[model samples]
Target: MTDQWVSFSKVGDAELVSLTGEIDLANSGEIGKAIVGRIKESGKVLIDLTTVSFLDSAGVRLLDALVGDLLGHGARTRLVVGERGAARMTLTLCAFREDVLTTDLERAAADLK
Candidate 1:
């Protein structure tokens, strides 16, 4: 498996987390930790999953946990998913909230503001 990487940056008041490669059992916990850490740093976060090549059940669980954590902290999170991919499928199959999912990066960033 190709090692997954999560890069962090900022867009207005929202932190942008860009995930690349794949997310599975090996790295989902690490990924979740990174995302939670960012949320603790910034109250708002936008997770960009456009470049993520794959996401398994572990990955989906990671995302779900992040969302729950953010809610508990009263922070906001927006997910920018690719138009098509494992990431998108996982979100869909899990019936994630449509209002929080989008394919347009610019729009997602703007909405965060």
Candidate 2:
């Protein structure tokens, strides 16, 4: 994908940061920064990893760190994971707690609303 291709998008009241291509060590910090910046702008953030083709340990760590930072900033965060191979693997490996990261965006938004 081109560098100009944004892996993120702000949709409605939620900032949807999509992870496309490979999320390895090189782009993990960038992804974290993008998410953090969006969180700073809006209290609500949703990470959509539906298009993510691959994720390494570095990517997972970055996501975990981002979640912690968002929590520290008192921002609400949710993760919308696609029901596929890499995306499913990432979610399962993360083992994210429901109180921290939610799987459904609509339910999360309703709760937040």
Task: Name the runs in model 2 displaced over 4 angstroms.
Answer: 1-6, 98-108
Estimated TM-score for each candidate: 0.88, 0.77
lDDT of 2 by residue, 1-113 (tens): 23432356666777766667788887877767665655676677777766678888887888788878776787777766655557568758777554645555566566555
- Compared with the true structure, model 1 gives a TM-score of 0.88
What is the C-alpha lDDT profile of model 1 across 45-92, one tens digit per residue? 888998888888898888888877776787777889968987888889
| Ten-residue stretch with the least lDDT total in model 2 | 1-10
Candidate 2's displacement at residue 110, Å, is 3.7
